[model samples]
Target chain A: MSRLAALVRGLDPRLKLGTALFLGPALWLMGLVQAGVCAVALLCIVAALASGQPLGGRMVRGLLVFVVFWVAVKAGLDAVSGMEWAQVAAGAGDLAVRLAALLLLGLSLALSASARALGLAVAWAVRPVAGGERAWKLALSLALMVHFLPMCLATVAEIRQALARRCPRCGFFLRMTVIPQAVIRALGQKTWNQTLAVAGRGLDGPQAWEPDFSWSGRDTRCALVAGGFLVWISLSLPFLS
Target chain B: MITVTDLDYVYPGGQGALDRVSLSIRPGTLVGLVGANGSGKSTLMALMAGLYTPTSGSITVDGCVNPGEGRAVRAVCRLVMQDADLQMLGATAEEDLLLGRARTDATVARARELARRFSLLPAWERPVQTLSWGMKRKVCLAAALLDDPRVLLLDEPFSGLDYPGMREMRGLLRESRAVGLTQVVSSHDLECFIDLVDQLVVLDTGRLALDGPPDAVLNHVRSHGVRPPCSWSAGQGVRSWDEESL
Candidate 1:
């Protein structure tokens, strides 16, 4: 692994999550040039973290498709609202960069840590306000969501493929209606089965939950780097604008 | 041991999946559950795994009552669901194998040992989504076995497996049985279980239609919407689908 990747992976998950949470709003509020620089930096970090992982390339490609599609929609809307062509292009580009940065931040965290670690981080973050039991419950729910999101996506894709095979020339309107209903039914059944599977593993309660993380010098360094980056972004905002 | 006495499971929608089903499974024996679609095979396995409380009757696994001692029953029984995708709740094979368990060095070692035994160590760190259908099933099986439950309930274990995958699953089942782990495998593919299972239990429209040794139940499975193994129809008495047997 690259040094950057090793550093991020060894950093505590709570620090990674905290950085992402802070960086999201920071990216959104930044000037276009600043956002672009941050986006590029985040992308590199994401790439480093994604190295040697199977789903990394797919995630990056998915992010590209998402950004492009949304940017096109946003630009078209701005044009319809009678915005100047130059402004429309600039606004769309800015939105695309910020969106990509946010997604890259999320992808980096996901690639760097396991679901359990992220879940524990969530629990720790929420424990003060939500109480121990409720915090753990929320954390477990988040972990289950992370675990099943891929399977849900795969199911949706399979349903779409089956529908296409059955009716090659199906209307777009019909597909929109049919697909959601089918997906909901399929996912509902899957959720029930998953609940049973989870229960069978004796995870219905939070009594056995334990955090498998500890602080280290690397974590301290990571927090310091994140703090410095945020400070730099704040200090440069006025000059960039 | 698993004991089901007059088990009736009625869904909230007023649909009955299992109706007065009664059966007993002795410890360490492999029981093959056969039926048609919606014949309650899956429901019975879920009930045995303590996923659901029987609507009227009772299910006891390793002497733990289903409704009364749900957690204890769950501890003693593990169910591998029909869709391996649904059962897996981990990003990677190793993660899934160690799900719901303490992540100590001993547990991690045990998970790796199970993975190696299942030939899953090579894909130990690979995302579960990238695995083949058979490999995904193996990962679920390995995860189910990690807790060392007394009874393992497998729903449609052979649904998506090819010849080699099926052979590997059969081998795993045989190994588990040898270790005195009671197993109830629900499958529509009777051929895979004919020569391997100690008892064949057939469910017909939510009722027990046949329960006996494979030879006795093989001839009657056809009446319950299940096809008899091809060899049985060919007058080959209780033959396995294994290539060498063929």
Candidate 2:
């Protein structure tokens, strides 16, 4: 696992995302909705894996849930306006591609960039916007919160289990109110204990994760390729219309 | 140096767990809080451990004392806690050790070293859930000892240990104390605690009844039957085991 982590440290996270974005619109122009988009999205998935991000199962389940939502939204839209099959396909295809790209891009970014490194990168990238002590803290906290987002997901599952009962109005009420309330009720000593542990040690200092990027031939070439892809995609927009 | 004077604690449900309790523990003494179940032993320990606030009276540590100051109080004095399962906050054995020491480069090696020495489970990078009850307890103890604090508060330090295991534990505690570490281990088992604790405390209900040397208290309790006289006064507290054997 440590070796795998070391291997991931070799690749540039930005390059992975750039690759996905470059391929997405290019594939859309190729008129191969499922094949091209799927290929691009699948490549992004491979990047996520190579970066040591374990999201295969999570992505599968999330896409399944998104399918249900897409169907419901599609049905509502069809009822409101009679649309042609080409338009429907485009809408659904775009929807699927957009969703897949977003998911895979997110995974790539997460896998390639660590919380500390990303915080440093963000702190560097958004220099003017992120210029205060509070801004730095906010950026660090946001990074930590994003990194620990999966912890809250387990709580959501627990809440769903609690709401696993037969009802219409009450079930609706629970769906609306249960999750947040359950989280509140379930916040126990462990969280406070961990915080106390950190605070007690005086370890909660300003995380000066200053970004350190060095320009190499690979980086320069990658950036040029990315820029060209964007230009091509921009020119092809009218053709799609 | 914690002095609990007329300390009383009750739960939110209006359950009177602790009555007025007064006790003073001098520095450099290994005190063990002991009692039967529901005797307010854990309640008073909880007050000292900073888990709960006394309803009335004062709970002080090293002359600096306050009620419900567990977070601050706990900083000076660390508690390993009674429940081992609740102590784990990491995803894996290595991560468990890295819970607080994540920033350091030697954190993994340090954790692995302690895990090996302290009988921590899942020998590999397996999840904490894979460990046994005893293994979890050892890991919790290792985590507590990692900081090497001025004071160590252990609840049932030897609950799941055999004779040899307890001896190994004693060696660990001995090493911890050799360097000015004040330890308070709250436990009911005084039999195996022959060489472990230096001081003894008995909580009869939420109130303190006995505080003195372990040997003196042990002899007194034995002579008068485990339950002391309904009303008793302190004199020459614990007679050293020179009379018997430590």
State which candidate has the highest lDDT. 1
Off by over 4 Å in 1: A1-7, A31-34, A50-55, A69-93, A236-241, B240-246
**How many residue pairs of model 1 clash at the backbone?**
0
lDDT of 2 by residue, B105-193 (tens): 47667777777777664444555555766667677778776765657777777888776667666766776666667788877666545
Q: Write the per-residue lDDT of candidate 1 for residues A43-148, one digit (tens) a residue.
A: 8888887776777888899999999999999999999999999999988988899999988888888888877778889898888898988977877788888888
TM-score of the candidate numbered 2?
A: 0.61
Range of the 10 consecutive residues with the lowest summed lDDT in candidate 1 chain A: A204-213
In terms of lDDT, model 2 sits at 0.61
What candidate 2 gets wrong by more than 4 Å, as runs, is A1-6, A9-60, A107-183, A188-241, B1-21, B24-30, B34-75, B82-112, B119-141, B155-180, B186-195, B202-205, B209-246
Rate residue B120 of model 1 by lDDT. Answer: 95
Among incorrect, acceptable, medium and high, the docking class of model 1 is: medium
Per-prediction TM-score, chain B alone: 0.96, 0.82
- In model 2, the Cα lDDT at residue A79 comes to 49
Worst 10 residues of 1 chain B by lDDT: B237-246
